[model samples]
Target: MKTYRSLALIIILSLSVNALFAQNKPSHTDSLMKAGIALTDAGKFAEAVAIYDEVLKASPDSKPVLYEKAITLNIMGKHDDAIIILEKLLTSISTPNVYAALGDAYDMKGDFDKATSYYTKGISLWPKDRNLWLNLSVSYSRQKKYPQAQAAAAEAIKADPRHARSYQNYAVAAYLQGKNAEALLGLSNYLMFGSNNQSLGACNVIKSILYAKPNTNADPVAKLEQETIAGAVTVATAGKTGLAPIDSLVLQLTASYKAIQSQENQFGSSFFARYFGDFFGAIATTNYMDTYTRFIAVSLSPQDNIAWLKAHNDDVKAFNIWLNTQKRQTE
Candidate 1:
């Protein structure tokens, strides 16, 4: 579960144990709270709820105890119960602080309109808060309210011009609204926001997700191959053994791939020369020069590179030949 975010709630959470002991004379409350927090951290939320309830009953008007109980209830998937406590807090407190908590609570209940109302209340009262609008946008989106979601995302962008998640949400909202080209552009902006220039792993993973959207009907098998190929590219580019001073080795293979994608696009692998529109030069570039000629058996078909690798071979030529021959063909 995405934990609710509100500075006042965080403040309350931090001082909760202190408030328990200081306001109520010495009791077993702090001990219970500590035990409850510890157990909850250990994934024992059910046990934690029992202890939280005892503490709340002992201090009926205590917001700290009530909030902690609500938190544990949420962790236990008791969203309705969590909503009750948070809503009750809202009525009695009626402050920006309470509005923030109520916003989070309603979001958990999936009562997104109320959540948006409360979040709006909090944002209006606390305009300088950097996090408020993003919180509102996410809640709006969970309910599939695209227009409202876009509005909230715009507000978030206005609040934090460079926020990456806001950009991603904007793209999704665009897609939901059937604005595919704009969605792709927004998604590209989201990718450009990242600073993973030196990390091929992140590059490949993001590229894989790019074409996996349902609209494109991209094949999962081909997607997996692209991702795996990218990994090998990353390892090669990062200079991780296999081929020493491997910059040339990596670049030759790099020519096998299209640029890192922000939307679904195909790589022209020799294995699918027909389907992917692969050219002989590109195939030869991808297939290591030495391996292409060497891996061809007497029958002229490429030998299986896996069988060669399994015996602890480092023959780059064989992999290239196998890769080229595997080019896509119509059945």
Candidate 2:
């Protein structure tokens, strides 16, 4: 089975987190910083680095310029260079942002020990910094230290109860440890406040497991399955213009589901039978797969998929209910 790892996701989230830490500056440096950011956004990393160099020449101690330069280097896969800059920033300025960046840089370099150490130091300096706690949680999770990961995630939640990513971190840690109930609860909270497509995909996989297991507590499983079904419908219907083409979107979705199946298949027939075998069989028998493929093929655009799903909402709902009913009957 595929191990639950979030390194790629953490790297993606770090870009936005760095953006939030960008400092305000005087007009000259501000313009340079903005230009660098634009270049970075346009995938012109070398140009962004040159612009940052110009900003640094003007104000050698410019925190914003240095911070953004480090981020650009990170995007360029220069983790060592980024770490050198971040460590220098920490020596002159003891801000949580610099410490968190240092931690992320080390984590990217696969030095989880140093990453956890820096994250802990950052948390000590800023007890209320939820992102530090979240980063610490991820570091621990990556190291397979579930108890520490859970504790760090709990601290993040305590710092900011409404932060959706904290819940996601906790859910991933819990899921890896086989704490299915806690994982489901954390995932539910994450889905409640976050609209990211990746989170939706994780929710669907977790709900599929819950729906398949026999001798499990029925109440929470039923409630979570229903919520997952409703959330999938909502996501399917929320597309707008300018999204990926319908065929591409269909390919992406199918690839993601296929990954889940591949992971489950590694555990042999008993595990498959207990998890996804019956689930796949039921959907295949109901012609749901045929209808879904047909819809994807005929949809004019990504938005048209939403309209088609809405028009067939009743059928989709019926399939969900029937699938769950079949699972329960077998149980």
- Residue 149, model 2: lDDT of 87
Candidate 1 wrongly placed segments (more than 4 Å): 1-35, 38-42, 94-97, 157-167, 178-331
* Deviation of model 2 at 200, angstroms: 3.7
Evaluate all candidate structures by whole-model CA lDDT and list the values in order. Answer: 0.53, 0.61
Give the range of the ten consecutive residues with the poorest summed lDDT in model 1.
293-302
Query: TM-scores for all candidates?
Result: 0.47, 0.59
Give per-residue lDDT, candidate 2, residue 301: 36
Q: Which lDDT tens digits does candidate 1 get at residues 87-174?
A: 8866655544456556767777777778888899889887755456766776777778876776676566556656676666765675
Cα deviation in Å at residue 189, candidate 2? 1.0
Residue 238 of model 2: what lDDT?
Answer: 59
